[model samples]
Target: MEQYKRKIALTNARFYAYHGYYHEEQMLGNEFFLDIICFVSNPTLNTDDNLVKTINYEELYRIAKEEMAQPKKLLETVVDNILNSIKVNFHEVNEIEVSLRKSNPPFGGDAATAEVSLYWQSGT
Candidate 1:
């Protein structure tokens, strides 16, 4: 049997939001970069290209945007929320990968950006 797989991805989606552990970081806000990829199993090839048959990346962006707007103490929480929201709405997706990054993290000295990534699979 031949297996068909499709990947829908949104990369480097930037947002300025208040999500941090410290009060100062939350109050000041920071730039966040998000990357997400959705995997879909195509049991049968679609002769006709239908938007409904595939994941809508625009909708994914909206979900990420909405989730990022809500303040949280950790990037892990944000990543989990985004993953869960997608799973709930897009039941067709078999797997999901999300990475959230906070630029110019506090702690000084040409600091590196803080990042958290999550991978999810159906029924796991």
Candidate 2:
């Protein structure tokens, strides 16, 4: 039998946070959006409809929320922290992808948002 990977995702999680390089950006705060995807092995194992057999999305949300609550200077740091936290908490996860977006970034242009996407695989 061929083995396949399963993915669980949380999309468009919105938060207001104080995360940026500039002091004003921190004090004033901005809207941040997160989309997280987690990959696991043997998705069919959860066919029994047991929560324990699958990744709990609420748990992921809680972890992201907790991590986002603390301010950080760069989105890269925030992404790293989230990825590390998820990996530590869920050993079954094989890979994780995160997309973080900040609205109205300080650059002097009509940019709607600034975004970062990061991918992490276990044992790499």
Model 2 CA deviation exceeding 4 Å by range? none
Tens digits of per-residue lDDT for model 1 on 1-124?
7778888999999999999999998999999999999998863455698778788899999999999999999999999999999999999899999999999999894857999999998883
Evaluated with lDDT, which candidate comes out highest?
Answer: 1
- What does the lDDT read for residue 55 in candidate 2? 86
lDDT of each: 0.93, 0.91
Off by over 4 Å in 1: 43-46
Model 2: per-residue Cα lDDT over 1-124, one tens digit each = 9988999999999999999999999899999999999999866576678998888999999999998999999998888888889899989999999889999999875858999888988783
* Decoy 2 TM-score against native: 0.93
What's the C-alpha lDDT at position 112 in model 1?
76
Query: Candidate 1 deviates by what RMSD?
Result: 1.5
